[model samples]
Target: MFERYLAALEYPSQGGINIDDPKEFRNIVLWLEDQKIRHYTIEDRANLRKTGSATDWDPAYAKYKIDLGFPANLKSKTEELTWLFLYAIKLEYSDNADRYRSITAAQKIEQEKKSSAAPEIKSTNPFDKLDFTSPDFEEGSRKLAEKLGIAYHPDHLVSLRAASYVISTALNKEVLKEPIITGKPFPIDEGIGMGFENHQDLEKAARILRLLQIQNLRKLQTAINETIVAVQNITADPRTDTSLGKVGMK
Candidate 1:
């Protein structure tokens, strides 16, 4: 019966259409237009729209949800699916749809249990270790964050001084601590109070940063030397007229 209804409506038999896929979902709009199913209330819209294009569903979806004693928002996908199952019944998709409803309910209950059992741990700082030298470097990070479903802030330092606290805390915990003598120390130790799980990891990261800095310095020095050498070569050329600057002699 469900299959028959979907066939009659020309709705896709396969399910799980993501709301974000605009190209694949334009078909739903066409189908609704063909049926002349316009001006649907939010409730009805939720029913027909199912997974995409809020405007495509009938407003009755809202009412269907209300009838089932669930909230209108249906925040979670499972919650929305439960409402969709009820909406399917309202559409006469199946005469004996209790089995489907039961399955959906079980799935919803399982989802709720899992969410309750293990709540996700939130990150304290989202943009940690995010550093950049150029604007392009930061832009690349922002693009990557979007693809990875992470929040990006145009916030991170490029200088080694900005990361000094991290390196100091990890490598020189003793220097950051109070003097063992217990007397007033001449220099107050500056520490961010963060500890490393493995000092070796911290050392490795610091080493890599140092190596990169050294490599960059070497490249800059080489470029500077090459420029100086080129200038010397030009000044020493015998074919050059000193005042006229490299005039070809007849």
Candidate 2:
């Protein structure tokens, strides 16, 4: 079924369709949605819990996990790369939503505060509002440091440097096509434990992480947009440069 879907999108033989093509991409998205619905119908029945049962009928959430793996499989394919492409757009939307909520919350807080201190800057840019206290940021930073053979410290300058490197790399590859390096393992330290040093540190860390997430998301959107433009140029005329140099040079 997945192969048939890819064939409909003209994968491989036609150098595959661009993820930015709204009409074509929407078809692919709808197909995915339909598949997900079908999968949920089957999985839900298999895992349905009894009214008074202490244990789930299907252990380990196998049904949902199996269904989720289909998307992951699509993401792993090189020839059928639309999954990651579409996934990036979804992430960009989520990040935008988060940024909006954060801004709204900040505005409310500012309005409630009666202190004489000057008003704080409220940036819509996601990177500017990263919160390092977030588990994602801390975990990502620690894992990255460990991978790079650097020691991980929660509040240390080195940890921040490591996080910046990790965040930059992820953004460059997953978000921006101008990746500094390719085929590198994501910097994540699974061994690092999670706990807050203090309330101040936690707040500061969360802010930093939020900023990084937003920046990364923005980069992804930009890269996707560039891909769309390149595809449009090619569709207009086949003589256009389709080489990696042209596509990558931007």
- Give each model a TM-score: 0.22, 0.21
In Å, residue 135's CA in model 2 sits off its true spot by 27
lDDT of 2 at 212: 76
Residue-level lDDT of model 2, residues 1-250, one tens digit each, is 4443454333343445445554444344334433322334543543332312326532423344355454544442333444533443454446466655556657756854655467788789997787767888777777777776677785645687866776676655666765466586644323332354357567556666766797899999999999999978876674666763344333
Model 2: lDDT equals 0.53
Candidate 2 residue 69 Cα shift, in angstroms, is 60
lDDT of 1: 0.53
Displacement of the residue 163 alpha carbon in candidate 2, Å: 10
* Backbone steric clashes in candidate 1, count: 13
Candidate 2 minimal-lDDT segment of 10 residues:
45-54
Error of 1 at 89 (Å): 86
Off by over 4 Å in 1: 1-141, 146-198, 244-250
Q: Clash totals for all models, in order?
A: 13, 24
